[model samples]
Target: EPEVTQTPSHQVTQMGQEVILRCVPISNHLYFYWYRQILGQKVEFLVSFYNNEISEKSEIFDDQFSVERPDGSNFTLKIRSTKLEDSAMYFCASSYRMGGELFFGEGSRLTVL
Candidate 1:
């Protein structure tokens, strides 16, 4: 089965630094999503993209954050200015159906120091 892939399985960055988390979603999937978990907290939706535009986004996707499909297969989330609160396990997910059965990547762990 095709799977979503993320880079820098673990990342440690200073509180004010910029970071870009990368993911390559399944080639045949039509919807892509980003979700994050803060240690023990519930997973939160960050954004969803389809047809080359953002379909939905949560409040957590603030002005300091941006997402893009840099290429046909690569999707990325850029945090221009990171905060301690930004430390979380960022997961990239994809689904063929839209009712929300998301298949997630192993996740990129971001640690803000």
Candidate 2:
């Protein structure tokens, strides 16, 4: 089966720095999302994108966060100013349709100091 893939499996950065997490979702999937798990916490939704625009976003996705489909197959999340609280495993997911079964990437672990 096809899968979503994330880059820099692990990244360490300082607070206030910028971080960009990259993802390549399954070619045929139409919906993409970004979720985060803070160590021991449950996965929390951040944002969802479709048709090259944001479909929805959580409160946690503030001005500091942005999502873009820079190209046909690449989706990305950018944290303009990383915060200590932002340290978490960021997952990239894709689904064929809204509310459909999701396939997640292994995750990119972000460590903010």
Candidate 3:
């Protein structure tokens, strides 16, 4: 089965610093997304990308947050300024079509101090 892949499984950053999280979705998938789960909290959607543009985004995706598929394969999330509340496990996911079951990557854990 095809799966999403993420790099730098763990990251530690200071407050106000920038961090970039990376992911590679399944080869044939067209829709990609980013989600994050804070410790002891439910997972929350951040953004969804399709057709090289943002299809959906949550309130949590503020000016400090951004996503891109720079090389058309690797999907990336960049946090312009990390905050203590930004600490969470970030998951990348992909789907063959809209509203379909998503294939997720092993999460990237971010710890902000």
Best by lDDT: 2
**Candidate 1, 1-113: lDDT as tens digits:** 78889998999999999999999988888799999999999999999999889999999998988989988889899999999999999999988768857889999999999
What is the lDDT for 19 in model 3? 100
* Deviation of model 2 at 68, angstroms: 0.4
Question: lDDT, candidate 1, residue 77?
Answer: 90
Candidate 2 residue lDDT tens string, 36-73: 99999999999999999999999999999999999899
Question: What TM-score do all the candidates reach, one by one?
Answer: 0.94, 0.96, 0.97
* Consecutive 10-residue window with the lowest summed lDDT within model 1: 94-103
lDDT of 3 at 90: 99
Q: What is the C-alpha lDDT of each candidate?
A: 0.92, 0.96, 0.96
Give the higher-TM-score candidate: 1 or 2. Answer: 2
Give the TM-score (vs. native) of candidate 2. 0.96
Candidate 2: residue 7 Cα off by (Å): 0.6
Rank the models by lDDT, top first.
2, 3, 1
Candidate 2 regions exceeding 4 Å error are: none
Global Cα RMSD, each model: 1.2, 0.8, 0.8
For candidate 3, write residues 7-90 as lDDT tens digits.
Answer: 889999999999999999998899999999999999999999999999999999999999999998999999999999999999
Residue runs of model 1 more than 4 Å from their true location after superposition: none
lDDT of 2 at 53: 96
Evaluated at residue 111, the lDDT of candidate 1 is 99
